[model samples]
Target: MVNVEVIATEELGDRSYLAHDGSVAVAVDPQRDIDRVEALLSALGLTLELVVETHIHNDYVTGGRQLATRTGARYVVNAEDPVAFDRVPVRAGDEIAVGAMTVRVVATPGHTFTHLSYVISDGDPAAAPAVFTGGSLLYGSVGRTDLVDPARTDELTRAQYHSVRHLAESLPGETAVYPTHGFGSFCSAAPTTGGPSGTIADERARNDAVLEPDEDAFVARLVAGLTAYPAYYAHMAPVNLRGPAPVDLSPLPVLDPAELAARIDAGEWVVDLRDRTAYAAQHLTGSVGIGLGPQFATWLGWVIPWDTPLTLIGESAEQVADAQRQLVRIGIDRPRGRATGTIDALADGRPTRSYPTATFDELRTARGEDPVIVDVRRDDEYAVAHIRGALHIPLPELADRLHELPDRRLWVHCQSAYRASIGASLLDRAGFDVVLVADEFPHAQELGLTD
Candidate 1:
């Protein structure tokens, strides 16, 4: 009997499926979390056969090729783009066989020109199929169409409309739907909240994007909610397309304050991989902090100069390993070392500092007190609507453009407290008295921010 297990990476908020038939297993959309997949397979006594991807993702660097390299499995994706490692290029109607199960490719080009969905069937006509609809479809929304060629927006939108229709009509009514992204993901039009896998019947009745039939109207609605792609995508896509180079995982020595100081003096960057709140409480001087939380790998690669060696300050040994792993996933190799005597070092005459945090009500009260509210969310999120007086400086750009922020009391916020805390901590270390709002901010009329 073939059993499908869904593995969710809490780090990237991405879901990948592992299908095992008690002998061989197939993995889809492997993110940076290969250890989970490896552990699952190890428990099942099954070997990996294939690693599949719907398309080249723009959000986080993919681990499909890397997993394949480590496991001797063949990497699979659309035939349009060339990929590294042993791969089997598939297109619409192509079938991939794994024991008694079969995965049929269905081209759904909107999120990306070469996006494809896989329809998994057990070979029995009586049993309904299960579709792996990567970024093409989600629980509450559809994938954003702006990431691809702007010239092909119309064409891609039309293609996406037909693709959705195809899934609705072509697949059996009871067919199960599985998507790669969910809520908190910036790839889709709206936040997606639900299980990693759902039924087409549920999505047909609940997903607003799927309810609309008029092609042009749907296209307009889809475009209206697109958030600006992270600055990392411009560089990540090419590296992923060319395939991430292999990384050496040797552990580095922990550097003392004097050693870290010298590295910083020579222009290297110190990355504090703790949570935003923890980092905000205290950090080393001149350190550019990027929390090792979800999106840690993506944001770290984006904000820091890739060529510079990174000195890490992790909360623990495990955190240090996690930080190192994340860096290698993006093909970043220069890990100078970990910070020795972490907190003790910061307290040793190195000008340690902390940032303040404010509750939602506190921020509202201070809005009229002449404080600058900086919204650190992406540009598109700010454009859709934001606090009237807030300035937009995405978290990825905050470290470099610290000068743009006025030298006064600053209040910062993001969709949640995580990003705001990180920004606040960075600014505080740079000698600014910053306050992080711990709640979601005003989004036009919906949020009650009149000023």
Candidate 2:
């Protein structure tokens, strides 16, 4: 088999692959940032001969078109995709020859109407091939069916069941399976088993799609398990289809304290990009603290109104630039302004606020005080396990439903404290007494906080 390198964008829970034969390479499902890919190609002394898109992705902007243009490689996409760009379109039963690799296309239309899987081998028919199953057959699960068209969820789920069975039966059991989603992406249907890498045999043994004999049952189970996804997902496909411009990661215009305060007063978003602990100690009164981390872009894009004039506050320009890269992946193309300095400097002696952060044990201590408990996890997470008396307002919905909260002090939490920290900030900004439960969920059970 040709040598394959997996490049993971852990923050987005997606992986892009580069396969080569010591001379030429093929890139699959690349993210918007092309520098990473170019760096890999230069390091390996391999020329990128082909860049492929498994489908018009609905999770993040694709860099295939731009990468192809810059490298002068042939950009290949499904012939059936209605993207607004020129490409070398191929269909099922077509095969392409690279240096020592042969790429065979297979139709796997469950993830989207035109999704394709690429099986690659190094000319030896006996050698097990590697299949790049973009969003079709994941580790032990499949790609979610609702993103393309929610109304067609049930129909697409049925298609997903059959497509998975087809792949398992057609390919060798030892064939290596590389999926692009399911690490933590909402685009992936949570499978029964997951690993860093898997094979067809492993999936055949444990995958729900292959194990479930009845198609209708598989469809129903898959559909029933679906949950809410990020609001930014709705824009990824359109941006991909319209053709994304080359990404720009340059520093943004600096905003002084006076301008930052003016933006907040004008009802614009001025988000703090510091860590949660530092934010809890001290933060600008009106700025919402969604700390800079893996989930920062996900929560920030979800809670803020789309296209709002946004300003970011960080302790350094590097922090703000990192946030900008994550934002561009989800189609939050630009930040209106930015500030990089200490909270004290950004505050410029203006009003500042701080809140208390506690664990489940501390929460129990404050129970007699009767503080409102709010669970900000998604419906699926809360449904599986949660404290009995806690209010269930998901983080995505919390900003919109603030008026529904009681005027009492509220304690906010999630599966982990990442989301809870963000929820606490929003509540604090709205003039509520907020205590962030900055710990894991298992502690709640240990402390007898769960029902």
Candidate 3:
């Protein structure tokens, strides 16, 4: 019997699997950090045999090559992929033997041009197989097809439609479906219905991509509904192709007050990782507040230039490291320095700024004769319902469209206080008088703000 241990990267909302049968094991779609995988292998007492990826990932750097080097395992990737590094090129119909398990490579494209799925059986051909559908077939929806090229979205969406059906028809109903994307990944075409995994039979019955009868309708809907991904996404494809360097988790150098000030003055990013409330109370001028949260990396990746030199200001060493780990997942490495205990920076003869964090009731009481209200939620969120005449600009597009916003005091809000806080900081740093609507958005409708 094959025992599968799933390592879910909660922050990224992606899962990596380690499947082993007594003596040998294989890792699928690991993150850039390999220590977790190493610990698993040591505990299980299984010799690593192979490391594999379903496709070239555009979400985060893969640790397959690094793990392979450490364990002396063979690295496998799609034969059709044009990666610069060498790997054991695999295609459909190729089977790899690992102790009591047999891994059958099955082509399942549409998430990317050269994606593959692995069907594993416990030696016996008739046993219910376990399928690893990387970015192809997810929990309730398929992966988005627009990530590769906008021009080929329709073509890829059509391919995705066929691919989901193929998995249902090809595998038995009892086959366990283990996918790499879903949970909270933006790569998903829609929000996943249940857990990280389910059976093929369950997916066939419930997944929209599988249940949709008309292929053209599915393609049209999928294409039209794709949301904005991170700006760092474009950089991942090339880095994965060229092979990402092994992750370094050593402590970063602390920046002196003078150097930090110079970098901030030179227009380099110095992100403060404390919560919005703390940042709002006191923070060095010119530093953007992207508090350490689930969407922290997403907004930072969205707003900052890819090549900008980044420095971090955190309340503690742990906070700085946590922020760095999240940033590295999206390929933002080599941050110049980390400034811990940044409260001291306020006394360095440099400017410090603060903004008001207000509730919806407060905004309601003072709405008519005040600063402009800007909603930084996504386009769909705004479309569903929003404050009637609030200016709409998704957080990802905020930096680009700053000039379009009025040069006046601005009240910024998102679905909740988290993103609104980030938006408020960005506006404040940009020299606009800003107020953060730090209350829950649903309350706005209940309070009649949306009306």
Candidate 4:
């Protein structure tokens, strides 16, 4: 029996797995940095026989080519993918042998036109299979069919329904299900509402895509549930099809306060990777505060233009390097320089700005001032229920919709205070008088602030 270890990318909430038999190992859907995968191989003392990609990923660049080149492992991707790179093309029903284990390719096209899932078996004909569903069937929902094209949404949604059922019927109830996009990834039809990996029995019993009575209802529900994803997603397919350039992780030059100020003045992105609250308290004016958290890279990729140069602003070298690693995973690797502890320098003489963090009750009292309440939550969350007349500008769209915002005090809020602080910081930098409604959104309803 082989053992499976999941390598999770916290920034994107993505999962890549390594499956190893006694002598050989296979890495599935690895992120761009091959160091983690190589470390695993060296630690296990097993030779990497293959590196497989389940699909043309539209979220992060894959490290299959690099891993293969570095480790002399054969690279495998679906034959249908129009990738310009060289690799062994896999088709549905094609099986690759790795020592005592067998990886059977299963074509599951819903997330993208060329998506594939790998079923790993112990080579015993009757042994139950373990499936890597890779955005096909997720924890409770399935992959969003709209990532490719809006016109193909209906067709892809139907295909997703059948593909999910195909896995359920072909695999045994005890078969383990591993998904690459889990833990709040935007690639899913809905956020994965349950724990990481579930068994076939558990999914068949609980997953809405599997349990829905008809495909039409499933498609309608799933399609309607999808909200805006990062705009960087559009570039992912072509980049993956061709190939991503190797990430450069060499130490970036540390910019002095004056040099950093010049970059900020020149309208370059000087991202402040601090906690949201800390950022709200005080930050260098014009620095965009994208807190160094799980979703930092996702939002940064979404808001920052693809070719724009970036300069990171953080408190420590560790924080800046960690941000760099997160940025490279999503292919935003052109950080020109970084500045650390600008806040400490500003504390003595230079100017710094802070925004007021208001609770729900406090917002109610201030409502008479007629602040422009900008709800930076996802559109689906806004539709579910939100404060009446709160302007809906998802965090991803906030950068482009600045002209549409009213010229009054902008009070920003999301489901939680995290996004609100980000929105508030953006608004503040854009010269708007900003106030952050820092309480939970549900607390608004509890306090009679929302309809």
Candidates in order, TM-scores: namely 0.87, 0.97, 0.97, 0.95
Q: For residues 24-120, write the lDDT of model 3, one tens digit per residue.
A: 9989998888888999999989899989899899899888998999999999999999999989999998999877888999988899988899988
TM-score of 3: 0.97
- Model 3 ranges with Cα > 4 A deviation: 345-347
Identify the candidate with maximal lDDT: 2
lDDT of candidate 1 over 144-210, digit per residue (tens): 7766677787777777777777787777768878788774566676777565557788777777656
Q: Write the per-residue lDDT of candidate 4 for residues 125-233, one digit (tens) a residue.
A: 6666789988898888888899888999999999999899888878889898989886677787886766767889988898887899798999998887778889888
Q: Quote the lDDT for 80 in model 1.
A: 90
Which pairs of residues collide in model 2? none
Expressed as tens digits, the lDDT of each residue in 1-451 for candidate 2 is 6799989998888999998888999999998988999999999999999998888999899989999999999999999888788999999989998789988899999899899999989998778889999999999999999999999888889888988999999999999998999888888887436668899999899789999999988998898988898998888889898899888888899999999999989988899999899999999988899999988888898888888989999989999999999998888878998998888898898999999999999898988887789999999888888997899999999989998899888999998899999999999988899999999999999888887
Cα-based lDDT for every prediction: 0.75, 0.90, 0.87, 0.85
Model 4 RMSD, rounded to 1 decimal: 1.8
Q: Is 2 or 4 the stronger prediction by TM-score? A: 2
- The TM-score of candidate 1 is 0.87
* Residue pairs with backbone atoms closer than 3 Å in model 4 (clashes): none
Q: Given candidate 1, what's the lDDT at residue 32?
A: 59
For each candidate, C-alpha RMSD in Å? 3.2, 1.4, 1.4, 1.8
**Native-vs-model 3 lDDT?**
0.87
